[model samples]
Target: MNDNAATGEKINQQARAWYVRLGSEQAGADDWHDFTVWLEADPKHIDAYDRVELALLDISPQETKSGVLNNPVGKPEENPSDKIIVLQEKRRLLKPIPRSYLAGIAATFIAALALLFSANIFQSPANIQHYATNIGEYENIVLSDGTRINLNTNTKLSVQMGKKIRAVTLYSGEAYFDIAQDTKRGFIVNVKDTIITDIGTAFSVNFYESTLSVSVAHGIVDMQSPVQKVRLTKGQKAVRLSGAKTMTIASVEIDNISTWRDGVLVFENAPLSSIVPELNRYFKTSIVLMDEQTAALTFSGVLNISDQDKMINSIEALLPVRVMDDGRQILLSGKQ
Candidate 1:
């Protein structure tokens, strides 16, 4: 083993010894002090000790009832023997029958540690590869599993593929996925607090504020959160508001929903407040609505996102509002 690996093994051995000694009635004051000093000396020592205690509980439940997990090193006794831990360990080996049985117990401890290490590895943001689009920029990505992802403007996502799992976490904006079938491995997408599991199908997810809207173009998906469970099929859409126990379901024209990926955004009765944000994503110049009344106004139409000035003028004609262009921005207010 290399230096780092060798050091890790040494810490595990020390932690195992300390755990057993503290559990018995023979641990002295010096044993407890040495443990505290070792624990304080390195941050990894504490983690190692925790794993040791957990492993003992899993392999030896009867010992757990003895209160080995009470404090810094379990409950301490005033009159304790330093040999108590050594004698207890000897009693365990007196009944062993074969080499394979000893190996099995060792494997169990290693497996428990492997699980902890895997969780730590995935918790780091760097584990997954990141893909993001700037304002007005769109992208098409083909994953290793033959999954096609089309990202809309200002969208960000992360993907991590393992041997038996494919996981993606959507950070902002929207995207469309065409997933390939893999019966042995499941595909999971995380949106806000909800999890979307694809059953060999394709879908789209839009995240805005605390709400997430999922539209399925083809196939089926199971959407779940803390308090709600919903299954959706092709040509169906669902919207979930933050803190709501249930989702609002509706049928949609799946063909026109994600048209923005092709340079066209079609909105059916979309609000002014919502429209302005979509417009801002495609233009460097910002659109500001002056009043709440104007923001609540809704309109329906197809917008060509390529031409910002024409789109702004088009909205001005559709709504009873005046649009003014200062030297820096466009301002809209109820005609007055």
Candidate 2:
């Protein structure tokens, strides 16, 4: 109401914009450094930053929408920076949010907002958001455009919700896409060295430790990389290996690999080495074999995806092995 309050509000708004921009991968090193310097330069900067941070601390991320945050003008334009490129790199390192925790995030956020306003120390910013998931969690989210995404654990993604060109970057981990049919706008998911273009289809991309895998369930996906480019149909999967010139394509038993989406773990002749990643992914457990011989053995079985114990039990049953849980790690060894 007063000029000072109004001025503070304006500065707060600008600070919020900077925070959201920083969330973008397009935000350059110089820009981020400058922004950080500027923030630390003034008291208003700290106040504004704290306000925005408090607002988003509990708010979970939503699915990416087409033209969601690029611009509100509803027009096609060039990407001014390497945001997409940075996003691709981030996606390769992130995973999805868990369903159990996401259910409470909204309520927690609303409460936090109310408390912030009651204190009246800082005004919350609505447009900017920062989302993250811990280990062993996953979530399905709906974006503004009605597009849906199933986020995996230990993932960080930021969405710049706008009227045109909705954009999202996977900061880490894996995800499954059931992109909303937006033929006019199209939905795109970026990973390191590859871009996934879709229109109303179900697909899963796993980017971990520099390895990227893309699997299509229903409909089609155009996977483009610097080395290889191809269109994938249902029941198809492609993996991009580090420093490899060619991407490996295989006709996969879809149900076995993708059953995680349905809470089922189906292993159709999948090797022990191949299953390690999936086990590490589903449970917040670290499994290391003491001997290379144990690592080389193959596994074949179907375990309930939702139950980590059952899956591990199945693993122990099939192999002569010893399992140890140290709370921080799970080690498997050959006993028989």
Candidate 3:
């Protein structure tokens, strides 16, 4: 064999190894850093890795259906060690051919793809991942498929990525979802008894005090309950009250729904009663209305939640109200 052909073969092997290594659970930040260095060391490395990835994608369905790849929802393998032996046998069969031969080249490419599938690069749905944020805390998460999720204060959720679906179960609090469109796999969110399926959209789901609220910012979302199903488009919101079989759909101001993400709350002539509960979500200190009349007062403004004292001062200055802090809680009463 010529030295050029031998060098190309070696580069292909290195690319395959890097691809599998990165897809595995063990790959870390350092591994990724080194991979970048290697990829940039030679332009051929980029082409080689791309070829390996494309080949795997082409053969994945056949391998998955034939049981060569791990089924996302299947039961555990009785003999996990057997997978290594099978991979070794396949490698041995492909290793003896000359690369100059067309059949040999095809066999080698298929062997590389087989190695990836046999290694179980795609995570199974059974491997659910749980994420949470503490009171007054927020978090951002990006999934393997490029979907982005922003968890609001005091939130908990679990994510499962499968071959046909990308699912998230919101156990509590609120989350904004920016779904990456994939024609093959659908994205769905489970909030209480409601199932929200994205149709190439960006949306938010808030579950608080036995109530489920969904607001769509872009594209479309299909929400299904036990009794009914509804589709929401941009500027639309759905609210399902506790113990109700059906949800109410309404038009909403889209910008107001996501202002909390910027550490501020925007209220347009919103009453004190409705606003206080939202403020409580971000702070340990409770804000209580001293009288019914105080709760009835309306305020229209933006309050920065980062500073509790400043937020309270702004509320008092804007409305006909007096704020008293007893250390335990902040009490609001109509100014006499």
Candidate 4:
């Protein structure tokens, strides 16, 4: 064979291998990512994969049902002549093919085409979608699988659904997920180094500067980091600081935890230091504590997030703090 023909044959073999591997149950996110990279590396890879799929379909049902396709390649008893006869009878082959090529074809034919079809690995752009919300804005999204997601201000996330799994990656901010239970395809959410796996659950995940918090309102979810793993159930919340080896799990009020979903911030004795950061996510004007004593003050109330001025006024009225707005930012100081 010429150099060009030899290279073509090598690519064809690789395409067949990828088809078999992807159809197996062991295929994962990394496998799919690698396959996509390979497919896009050269246009000929697409054509080669298509030929392998067509070749598999051309095989006779009687031969496939008889378990001839399941036999491993390079078996001494397996006859390449038998497959060539079937291909020739089906009018798919115009000339004689090599025995080694026939062996590769037989091995690839063992995988069901249905799995490949469901995967839709080639149309990656369509399979993966991104959603985001601007500051002071909230958006609701319902996925095809009936999963509902409520995105808080300045939040960004991506959803990628595969044949065996539904994955969401939260880039920043907060989101509440009402997952649709699928026993065969598990739901997972990824935030930085943390992984949250849903088990028929409704939960909220918040990813701020140096903290990651997961609060479960219903059902259960498993949260895992590099060094720790914990299962959270209804009314439970897990908080982990950046680079921490362990997470702090505590019981919480689900209603109070999810009040942000209703366009309100509910705080029960939450410190001014923590409240300022939450408010900063919604408004363009940054909130700054003028002193440590001011930051230590606690407030307990529900404040409407829609109006920034009203929220600031409510905080000033409810707590012993003075708010000073210099047009660019708001400064909070303990009352004299």
Best by lDDT: 3
88-197: candidate 1 lDDT, tens digit per residue = 22122223235654465455446534633454454564456777655566677888889998877656777877656678778777899999898877887887557788
Where model 1 places Cα greater than 4 Å from the true spot, the runs are: 1-127
Per-candidate total of colliding backbone pairs: 1, 27, 0, 0
Candidate achieving higher TM-score, 2 or 3: 3
lDDT of each: 0.72, 0.63, 0.75, 0.74
Residue 174 error for model 3, in Å?
0.3
C-alpha TM-score for every candidate: 0.60, 0.58, 0.63, 0.63
lDDT ranking of the models: 3, 4, 1, 2
Winner by TM-score between candidate 3 and candidate 1: 3
- Descending-TM-score candidate ranking: 3, 4, 1, 2
Instruction: Measure candidate 4: CA RMSD.
Output: 30.3
Q: How far in Å is the alpha carbon of 180 misplaced in model 3? A: 0.4
Task: Tell how far residue 57 is off in model 1, in angstroms.
Answer: 70
- Candidate 3 — what's its lDDT? 0.75
- True-structure RMSD, every candidate: 29.3, 22.1, 24.7, 30.3
Query: Where is model 2 more than 4 Å wrong at Cα?
Result: 1-130, 160-164
lDDT of 1: 0.72
